[model samples]
Structure formats: C-alpha cells, structure tokens
Target: MRYMAAIVLAAALLSGCQGADKAGVNGSSPSSQPEVSPTAMSATPSAPASSSMEEPLLYIEQLRIIGGGQLVQVKSNIDIDQKSLEQALKNSLQTSDPETEFRYTLEWESPRFVQIRLHLDENSVWSGTFNLDEAVTVDGRKYASTEQPYRNTVVIRAGDGEGSLLFQGVTSGTRRVVPAWNTGWIKPVQTRESVAPSYLFYGQEKHHLVHALTGEALEIPVFAQEKDAYGNDYGYHEMYSDRFYEDFTYMISGNKTLYRVDLKGFTSKKLHVFNKPVYGMSSSPDSKRIAVLTAHDEFIGPGADLTVLDQQGKILHSRENAAFISHSDGFLFVYSLAWEDDSHLILPADRDEHNPLGQIRYNTGNGASSVMQDERITDPLKQDLKEHERQPHNDLLLSGLKWSPDNRFAAFKSGTGAIQVYDTQERTFTFVSAGTLLGWMPDGTLAWADIKDLVYTF
Candidate 1:
C-alpha cells in the first residue's frame, strides 16, 4: 500500500496535465510565455491550502524543533554519501562581495527524514535545517533560536563540536504561524505493548488503507484519538467534505448497541445504549441526535430500521427507514456526519442505484436528495460526470471519510495509501495528505494523540 501510494503520488506529481492546460504551478503566470503554440500547456496544481490560518501543515517528511533551532531531518533507504555532502557543502558556501566571511547553505540531502529547526549564529547563514526556529550560542552559551547576524557572516559554521557542517543561507526571526498540536496522547501512562493505541487527531479519523514497512497492507481503522475534545469532540468522531454533510466516515467498535453520547450523561451517564443492537453507529449533524440501525427489519418483518434519540438519551423521532437522517442521526458505517443543508444530512454509505461508492446526501425531509460527492468512489461512480457522483478509484480503495476543522472538504485514504479530498459544494477534489494510511484528521490539520507509549502531535 505504501508503494502504491508512492506510485500514485509520483504519477500525480508527474502526470503532466489531464486534459489540456499549461505546465505551470497552479497557473502562476507562465514562467516564460504561452507563446504562439496551438497546444495548451499542462500546469502543476498549487500546493493545497485551507481557509483557517491555524491549521497545521502536513509534510511528506517529519517536522520538529530541536537544538533550540528549527531543523529538518532527512532519511533515506540509501546510504548517506559524505563525499556528496562535502561537494554540495563546498558549492553551497558563499561569501559577501567584501569577502569578509563565508556563507554557504547546506540543505540536507535525504528524502525520508523530517524537517526541524535548530541553532543560529552571527551572519546566520541559515542552514538547510534552519527556518522558523534557530538557536544562537554566542561564547558557547546556548540561547533561544532567535538571534541576529553579526560579523558579516551569515552562518555559525558549526565549529568542531558540531558533527556535520552544512552550507547556509540568510537567517530569519519570523516563526511559522502553525497550530499547536494536542499533547494528551502521551500524557497518559502507556507502554509499547498497549492495544487500542492512542492516536493523533490532525483532522479526524479517515479510511485510506494502511501499509507497514514489511509490505503488508490493510484498510485499518486509524485516527488521532483526541485533543482537548476539540470541535465538540467531533474530531474524535467525524471527517470533512465539500458538501456540508455528505462525506465518508466511521468508527471501529465491537459494541454496536451504543448510539449517541449524551452531554448531560457526563462520563458514566454519558454512555447511551441503543434500544436496537446493530452493526453501525451514527451521529446527527446538530450534535443533538443519534441514529442506529434497528434490528427489527434485517431478519424479521417490516423492520423499524432506524432509531432517533436526543442528546439526553430520549427517543425523539423514530422512523421506519432512516435512509434520510438529520445531523442528529448520523449514518451507518460512517464515523462522522455532515450537513448538506438545513434539511439534508451527508453520510458515507453504499447505495445500490448509485453503485459508485462516493458520498451520498440523503434528504431527511422529503427524502429528496442528490449526490454530494460521487467522485471519491472511484469505481462506483464510473467517472460519469453526467451522474450525480464520481466514479471511484481503483488502486486506492478506501472509505470512512471525515471533514476537517474548517468544514471545507472531506478526506480519506485509498487501498493504496493515497489520500484524497472532495470538495463538499464544488464537488471537485484536491489532494491533501498521502501515505501508507492517512490517519488523524482527514483534512490534514495537526492534532495530538495518546498512543499509550507516546503522546505526539503533527
């Protein structure tokens, strides 16, 4: 699955252009000129962005702050070539016109590692690992990462004490304005052997298949556990999508009896069990109601298929077939819920008529609903733009979509570990997080996780 994701990512990065377009980065005014050529140019899509400024950025590599500096770490299956680094370091080094000092920047030459910020110095020739956070140690005294340049030298040169000295660039005091991740996942006492390992909630739980280094793959249920119960604890339950509520999401649980969590119920009383024990669990868009698959029909007569209960664990509106449910009543197989409009609820489910397995919006009012997102269901939608949904994908077969914090779109991982996002309203798609299994918030915003052994956030 990881390999598949890597391939998909590679193809996506090098696909040229789908139909006919210019080869530009999100069409940022052609580098050169469009020219008098008749053929249209293909362009690279711009990097993904969210409306919220606080969203944590998702990087293909790890990001961190260490050595009192903002440094980036790189990893590679191949061996690190010190000779190559020396050559690169030699080329990266540069001095001012006056030739008072040297300034060479050495960007780490690895691919699989992460990015973190570390030390700074006079002239602060920002290292490849320098950015956002940079520490300064004048006279051998370690100081904060924020330090100014002096002596016309733009770098510290990582004296003999330093293991490796890379080239450098200009130093900066401005730190990146990224959201702070949750820290609860690690706070709890956990061990390496803990089951139901805690998780991070960058956005919310989403289903893109997961793969291990051993080449084993499975559509595992994974997500960031929780961070201060953000978004009314929805991050622990839902995913994002373009169509307000129509999206794919779900929870992995053996206990199918419990439906809605009552606010008044507190910890113990908060647990609300459904009258009908079934396979799926869903929540209402309003966060006021809950819906569960009633057992009355599956094996018996005209089954009272769905049960609707209020936040207080009281029955509100019980319908025969809750094919149409409100935010108060989430959908089956969907760990999350969204709102298409005041009258409709967007849920991720498998519909026969629209066999294409994208997100389907059900009109709870008059049962008059349309397809909110069919494109995600690669195979099911058959790529029929004429139809309300999109044809599902093949290599990447993942489900259980979730909305992000900003409530803009939905995201999920495919069987191959490729992560995709579907606009709720525009019905278009934009790639967000991509890996063996895109866990945490589907939107890719950073959140914290408590996996028993460690509590980390991204």
Candidate 2:
C-alpha cells in the first residue's frame, strides 16, 4: 500500500546522494556522524610533534573518498593524543601496529566513487588522519600514502548529421572512447566475432542489420512491426539464444492470446490465452527457462501472477497473486521480472509493514523466494502520502528492465530519457542515454540504440 510513498522517498534519497559532491565518514553510532559534505577534502598541515597526555575518546583509523577520475579526499582517522603523527614534509612510510585493524566500505556516489575506512578499538574511535607526511593531506592533516586514482572515465557523443558513429572503445582510466567509422541514420551493432561491426535499423518496411564497412544488408525478417491505436508501428521484444546463438525466441501478446515464437524454427506456440493482456516476459541466460507475468484491470485492489516454463514448453511453476497491493488507482505494476541465472528469478514485490520497496528473488531449483532489500528506498521519508494513492507510480517508467548479457549490469530506461545502469559487482549505479540496450557486445562494451536507431557503445 505504501509502494508509491516508498518510491517517492527512494527518488529523493537517490537524488540527494547524486547531487552531493562529497563522501561522509563518521562514528559507527548514527549520532556521531557529521552532517558535513563528504567532498570537502584537503591536506592538513603538520602539528607539533609530541604525544599529548590527553586520552582520546575515539580511535579513528582511516577514511578515503574518490570521485570524477581522482581521489577527492583521504583522512587517517587517528587521534593525535596517543601518538604524535607529525613527521612533516618527509615522505617516510612505516607500518602501523600489526594488531591494529580497521573497517572499510566503498560507496558509489551514483556517477562518482567514494570509499571510507575507519579504525575502531572496541567502543572507542580514533577519528582523523594520522602519521603526517609529504605525500598527501586531508583537512590539513598530512599522510604518507598518496591519494587513490580514478578507476574509469567515459565520453558520449551524439552522432553526426547522418545519426551514426563507429564503436572503438570506452574512455576509462587511461583509455578513451573513439569511433572507428561513420554512417547514415542507423543502429551500430557489436557481434560475437567483430568489434568494428554492423548496423541494425528499421527500414521502410522491416528491420535489417547492415555491415558498417561493406554496406551489406543482413536480412532479419523475424522482427515484425505492429500498429497501435494511433497507427504507429512498433516492433516487439526479440532475443537470441544464449551462447552459440543457435536459436532465438520472441513474444507477441495479442488481444486475448500470448504467442511464444521460436525464430530459429519459425514456429509459434500459444503459451496462454488470458482474459487480460500479458504484461511482462523474460528469459534465463541458459535459454532453458522463461517467466511470464500477467495482471487484471478491475475493482480489486491490485494483483499479478508469474508463471515459469521449461525448455520443453511445460509449466514448471506458477504463483498467483504473488504481487498484490492497494492503491486508489488499483494499479498493480508488474514492472519487470528477470532471471538472475538459470536457477534464480528476481521480481518486484510490494512494500508492506516490514519490507520497504523490496524485490523477490525466487530460486527455481529450490522453490525458495527471498527478499533483496535496498535501504536507500526502504527507509520512510519525512512526508507521508494518502494511503489509497500509494500504488507504485514509477513502475511504468521502469517497465523495460533488463540485464546485460554478461550479467554484470542491469540496464533500465529511466523516465529522464537516460538509461540507469546498475553494476551488480560494485553494487553501484551509473547513467547513460535513453536507448534500447542490446546487451554486451563482443568486445565487452555496452551497446544501445536511440530513438533514431543510432547505436552507441560504452
């Protein structure tokens, strides 16, 4: 019932973190954390070089934050009372006490990176930089180690007049994203065997993939366009079989029927005949599993179902009303359900009294479903919304949720006309232009197409 409120809170919180240019380091206790912007980092000057008799209430170990291709700040969270860290202007490195231990955490400030570390001794904290030297300084405190460098840098260019550009590589660390060639309005593609690859675009009648260099039009007749109420034609979803591309599959949800078609054999199967339209679909990486979702439009609060099938077209599992919520709009947003792997499928679940905007990860092999919670959005906001209108409002904007071929990133189109990419490994997010994410290319670069069928890679 509070799904909408949870989403509103999530958006505001995510935005706040994005706009802030600093990393925050504070005591383990919430009350001890400072409200200072994490970005204000500088080298601290050396202090008097003698240990003071004053006892430290806290023992801070270390803290660091990096952003925009450079280390933004580094502070050794060590109190000056116990040990006189002042060894100014000289860059001498000495190992600290072998028994000393610290805690570390890496946070991606959306488009940037931030890492914070702190040393703690039981309940006490030694907060601030230690061992002043010449290499770097934080808040005027000198340190022996140099700041960490940026991990990556990327550049995106809108295509020339023809709406096309080449895909060379992405700018990261020392490497840069450069184009290899140019062409007319088209969608460039990265294939299994090639990097300087071809283009896939919608022609006057159908879709085609043309070789960028040779100008050869590779015919792909499987993509058929269907017209909507306004007479605008649009193509449906199609994906190739994993691994060798030996087969491909697609879906066509008609008025009362859902068609699962195998492009390799040019065969169509009526997977389901439902009174309500089929709303969502996704396939597993191994091409052996498929999950389909459907919902009803009615006076009932809101409800949806999920059905999984195997390679032999047999129903493996089905859950009715797995997602149910109450809102004035009575909207049940089955945004997207995806297979994390052959055995795991992740779906959005309604936020209840216990779980915040939570997601359900179902293990097909074990029939176990667990919730993967994100604290950023789950935490309640200061403002409250009317209970009846609390249905998830942003679900439609994120209906196109998809995972990259490599499973390292989950790419979804944000309402802001950009793609929000979630790095599974780093547990961080980055933004890209609004394009149809074609998954990872042969060379490990991300590829997508804009409204005009212009392909870009990063």
Candidate 3:
C-alpha cells in the first residue's frame, strides 16, 4: 500500500518594485513589469504584502515533506518566478510513477511567507532545489546556474531512502558525513540526572585519552605504540566503565593491560595485566569486580578464558576455555560481555548452525555456567537482534551493544553507522546520530564520537 506523501513549501515575499528596479532586467520599469496571471495565483490565496506595489519578490523559505512514514524538512532562501512555481513544485514532487496525481494547498504562515502543502499517494519521493537567480533559458527549459558557490552548494536533497550530510572543519580539513536523518534539529531531552564519565582515544597516533564530557586530554606514557600485522596502531581500544569512578575511568590498553586514569589529575595507574591479549572486559555494577576475557591471540579462536578479578587485580575466579566453543570454522567466538547484576556475567554467544544466537550466564558467586534464561536480559537482547535484522541493509557493521547502567536501554551502532538506542521497556529505537559508541554516562546519557567531536545525547 502506498502512503500519502505530504509536501509543504514556504515562500517569503519581498518588495517586488525594489527587487525589479535593482535587477533592471529586459529594460522594463517597475510600472511596466508583467503581472502574474490570476490563473497562476488562483490556487494560493493572496499573500500579505504591499497591495500598492505592482510585484512582490518571492523566495522559497522552507520545504516540508511527509510521506511513507518519514518526514523531511528543508530550509532555503532561493528566489523563484511566481508563474513557474506551481509547475516547478509539481516537477520536483513527482514520484517514480509519472502518472501519479497530486494536489497542494496554500496556507499563510505569516505576512511575509505562505506555506504550500502538496499531497501525493506514493511510497517514495525525491526532491531537489535550484537557485533561479543564475538560471538560464534553454529551449524553454530553465537550467540552474553553474556558478562556483551556488553550483557546489546543495540547497536541498531529500528522499525516502538513506542520505547523509558531509561536515568538514573550516581549517582542520577534518571531514565526516553523517546520516541526513540525524541532521534535523531536536530539543535536548533532560532524561538523566548524572551522566556517566566517558573518555575517547583520539590523536594522530591514538595514544592520548580525551574526556568525552570535558575537553581534557592525558598522554598515556605506557600506551603500546606498536602496530599490528595489518599496520594498525595499537592503543587503548575500549572504555570499560564510565560509572565506576567520579574522577577516573577504567580502560584496556592494546597491550592487554588495564589502567585506571584520573580524569582530573590527568594521570594513569596500572590496574592489572592479562597474560594473554584481552578481547573484552566488563566491570560489575557495584564496581567491585571486573571480568576479563583473554584469548591465545588477538583473533578469535580456541583457548579463550574468563577471569573474575577484584578491584586490586587479585583473581577471585578463573575458568579455562570458558568463553568460547569449538565449531567447524574453528571456534564460535564469544564477546560483548556485560554483567546482568553484581553476581552474574552475561556473554552473548556467537550463533552457530546447531544453536541460534543465545546468551550465557556466568555466576561469579559459584563459578557455574549455564544458558541464560532470565527474561529481563534475554528478552531485550533478542529484541535488539530482531531489530538489527530488520534494517534494510545487513552488510554494515553492528557492534558495541552496550546496555545502560540501569539495564533499561541497549545502544549499538546500526548498519548505517547511526547509534541506535533500544529501550528494553518501551521496545523502541532512538537514532542517536552516526558515531562510535563510547559507552554511557551514569545518568543514562549516551556518549559517542562523530570522528570530529564527542557527542553526548539522551
């Protein structure tokens, strides 16, 4: 079934006499300027402008389109001819099927602008804008200007499918293209009281830690500056806890050593070192215990072990080959570790033919393992996976499924690079923009990096 797509165009009217006199076009005086036919202006009510003036300067102010369960709003200030505005709207609002019929209504938003609402029965819509100031007439067709600034700038490009906006630093030359859906302005919601302290590993060599909330940085004196076989530099790869300390955060270095860094003093203290490389780490909700996963090598395979350590790095429980299982492909890798509570560690097991994607519950108190049956945790994980599969494209990476400290929301990077937060209780997804998930602040706010800056959203 096709949904009705609604398009609303807002146009601002200026003094026609002044605009025409300034242009001095066709050797016509303001008094001799051609009048817009009543038929051309019949659909729209008379705009609130100077009735004494012979003409009114018209420019598209904003365009809002709603259809196919999506809404796109574009803001611009491009001049357009009144006689051709109706036909231009129709041409730009056309769907894939050329025969589709549509209608529009005009509403006066203010004395300066009028809103044109176009309604169509279609599944998708594509629209673009043109700067009519520099347009040229060719065979009765108006071609947009090819001038430098106007030609390079895209006033509006809206569609039902995925789109992105490229952002670049004015002088730094740093560039990032985020999903266009995230470009819409939204009022920040006050949903949390205190945010978890978040940090990001950023620098030319990624050997520096910057606080996500504050613009503070600390150089890791002992950070592993080595490179992998693939020429990828190794440093701090993940931030384990943002809720553990007020002035410190727990992070794992590339060399398999964990450290607690002071966010205020800008110092680092070695916490513990794993014998093998660390794949994943999770701190208990109480911040008293830490679960570390280590494997024989960096790549996923056999010989994966799980260790429960105290805050001082003393081992409380150890299990060999407990995190993964062997399969035809060599091993079913287990990662994305989190704690269901202070006593139970939850591991999302990799899917295999014999077993669907499931979770393993490791009891820290008894050192026993079993299939996770807690509906509270399993249900949310299952729902999150189901939503991930429903995304249009599946090839994109969907990683970093971290649960909120309260276990109410699960945040992950969707296929389109947008950080989607899934509410376990509400069973809904919130697009938090395109970036790397940098864990959550204690107050339920999410922290992420958009390659250019650290973004915090709730």
Candidate 4:
C-alpha cells in the first residue's frame, strides 16, 4: 500500500554558521599569513602544513549550480589561504549579477561530510551535502580528493534554487583562471502549471481528482472494502488493476469482481469477475473495450492470462498464458498491457532464448499473435542505453519506462537518479527531479512522487 498526501512546496533557507568549525576555520588567525602563491592549485588535496605553519590550506572540491535553465558542475580547482575563512568564501563566491548577493549556511554531518544551504534570495535557495573524502568528475575535469588528510573539497548536492554563480579557479603557472562554465549538460526546467494536466490518483485516504493547471484536488470516495479469506472486513485497499475508463468513469477490481464506476455520480455497477486474482487492467483509447491481465491462480506467480471484454462486460477474447509476469524487488505485476487500437492489444509474452523479455501484438478479431515491431517503443529504450553510457557512472541500468497518454513523451529513471523525459516529437531529452514516474494526466502532463511531495511536470 502506497501512502501519499497533498504536495508541499517549501523553500528551505539555512542561516548562520552552525558547522563552520568542522571546515577547519576556528576564527584563530594563523601565527603568520604565508604569501599568496601565484602557482595554480593542484586538483589533489593540499599537503599538510609543517609544524612551523599554524593552519592548513582550504580547497574547493565540487560546486554545482542548478537554475537559469541550466545545471552546471564547476570544473576548476580553488585554493583559499586567507586569514579569515568567512572573508575568503565571500570573496570567492559571487552571483552572475553584481547587484544581487548570496548567503550560505554549513552543517557538519561528519568530519568530512558537510551540508551546505546557499540562499541566493528568498525565492531561490539550494541545499546539498558535500563529502570531502570522495572525488567526482564532470566531463573530463576532476575535483576534490580521493582520501584523507581530508582536502577542503565541497560537493553541493542537488537542491532547489534559481540563478547562476560565477567563481574563479587556479591553474598551474597562472595568476588566477576562471574556467568556462560547462553548459553542455541537460537543463532542468521549472515546474509550471501551463504544461500540467488534470489527473486522478489514489491517495492514502481515498481517490483524488487533481487539476494540475489550477492545483485543485477533489476527494472521491471509491475505495472498496477489502476482505480476507475468512470474509472479514480487512481494510480499505486499492488494487493495481484499477484504472480510468475515459475521464469520468473508472474500472476497478476487488478480489475477483470488477466494477465500473462513474465519477460524476459516484455510482458503481458490476462489470465482470475472473476465477483468479486480477493483476492489471487497461482501457482502450476509445473506451469501448477493456483489456485485463489476471493471474492463473491465487498464488499470483509468473504467468498470467489475458481477457478482453466489451463495455457490456461480455468477453470478446480470452487466452491462457498470453502474457508474462515479471517480478522486481519482490513485487509481482505484469508489464505494459495496453491497447494499440480498438482491435489490437500489446502485451508481454513468455521469455525465450532469442527474446528474453519480449512483447507481442494480439489481435482480438482473429485471435492471432505477432511480434511487436513498434520503433516508438524500442528507439527510446536504445536511446536510454546510449545516454547511460555517456554518464560518469554507467552501472545503473535504466528502468520504469512510461509513455504519456498522447504518446508524445516517454519518461524513465536515468542512471543519476533523475527522471529523464524523452520527447518523441522533438527527439530530445530533458532531466527532471528524482522520483517515481506515476501515470500521466489526460492532457499528457507527467506526474511523479518522491518521498515527501507529489510533483506534476511535462
């Protein structure tokens, strides 16, 4: 059971010096300030000062800025050797606009890990943690140190902010070099209501009809009373097979019984029932037919049967072991079992040597199955793999491919934990915040949920 509530949009503003001491800035000045070195800072952690020196040098490890339609990872090395750490940071970090200034707060989690909250303004703030012990590389340039005596490497985690920052780094045999900002990476767009759409979602208490454009949600009492094998009112539960039939009507399954519900009047009628448990359901584009995927037995294991039914609950076609069930993280569910048209259904087939996980196009008219050859589905998967290879870490495989209602956009989880949306029309990709890709709204806006908030985006 998934628990969710209304979205909470809060701007986190961290203030004051809470963990600045952990950064090795103890307000006590060095016995003697060494002459500023003209040599470029080394990418590795600075060597520890000798017993004659009073303080160790500080270095900027990793700095990332997310805003202004761009995600920037600064590929430069900065060394600070001033008497005051506060004055050194203030002089080093600056925004694009000279008129606007910024403030920051640091909270030390461990000796080397510190959480930084940078506030550019009341509306724009970013908070992320930096681990000084790890080394991260963007493109070909690297920042921070691999191990201790702990270099002053600052890696800012992704946070909510708007605007850009400009900072200079040191290069060998030079006075000071301001490296060019790498803007080649994908930019994260702001969440806007203009591109959002209306949709329905199952909440912790009941069903919610959400209007994304206006940010309004209406509660709809539609949860069926679930019962155990002994026939007691176990609790209220929403099944995975529950889906919308057009905009106002919904088809949901409880136990082995199916119900057709009208949202406007809150009325429900019996549709159909299967001998076993219902695994998944999808309504046709025309809403004239429904395709249901059911488990073969109560155990609900690997294989499932497919049943196509008309709006009148009459079975148009039925096949045993027509769809294959895949398990992930201990959850048993069928893959995409959607209707390509009123007469054809696209469903997963059993695994084979040639096609380990494949799908087939099942024709309801002739009861024939054929290999699915739609490039609209296959091309984006190939693109995800290609995109994954370009990432710094390629071990994280892409999963959870979800297409929009109009089939204009496809979304999936990328290797970096961010949700990457592929625009099939433009043949481009955009990165969004990390979350689970919920179903798309009627107007094609994508909905997703992180641990705390439910975000709607396009």
Ten-residue stretch with the least lDDT total in model 2: 148-157
User: TM-score of predicted model 1?
Assistant: 0.31
Give the per-residue lDDT of model 3 (tens digit) for 1-458. 00122332222222232222122112222332222211012122244533433332333333332222211111113223333433444443322122434334433333233344334333233222323333222223343332222221112223333332332222233434333222111111111223434242333333343443443444534344324311212223443342445455566665367777675675677778776666567777667888887775456464468888887778899887666644433332224577778899876555442324345788888888877433344644565555544433222223236667777777776543345667776677654444445565555555544332122221
Q: Report the number of clashing residue pairs per model.
A: 101, 26, 4, 3
Better of 2 and 3 by TM-score: 3
When sorted by TM-score, best at the front, the candidate numbers are 4, 3, 2, 1
List lDDT for all candidates, in order. Answer: 0.30, 0.39, 0.44, 0.44
Candidate 2 lDDT over 1-458, as tens digits, reads 00011112223222333443433333231222222322222333233343433211111112221211112222233332112222321122211122334342233232212323333342221111122233222223323222211101111112232333222122231211223223222443433444445655644444456554455555555434333311211223332221122344535333234455553555666565544545456677666676766664543235667777775556888887665445444332224466777788877666654544446888877778887654323112101111111223444423334545455555665432344566555655554443445444444455544333233221
lDDT of 1 by residue, 1-458 (tens): 00101112323332332232222111122232111111111122244432332222112222122222222222222233433333433443332111233332224323211222223343332222111111211122221121221111112122212111111111111211111223221111111222112222222333222111111212223333332321222123322111111122222232332322121221222334444424334555445555554434333222235554655667755555544222333222222334444455654434345533344576655655566544544443334221312223332233355445554555554222223455555666542222212232322342211111122211
- Model 2: how far is 375 from its true place, Å? 10
- For candidate 2, report its TM-score: 0.40
* TM-scores of all candidate predictions against the true structure: 0.31, 0.40, 0.42, 0.53
Q: How far is candidate 2 from the true structure (C-alpha RMSD, Å)?
A: 17.9
Q: List residue ranges in candidate 3 displaced over 4 A.
A: 1-201, 204-243, 296-303, 325-334, 352-358, 373-449, 452-458
Quickly count the clashes in candidate 2: 26
lDDT of 2 at 93: 21
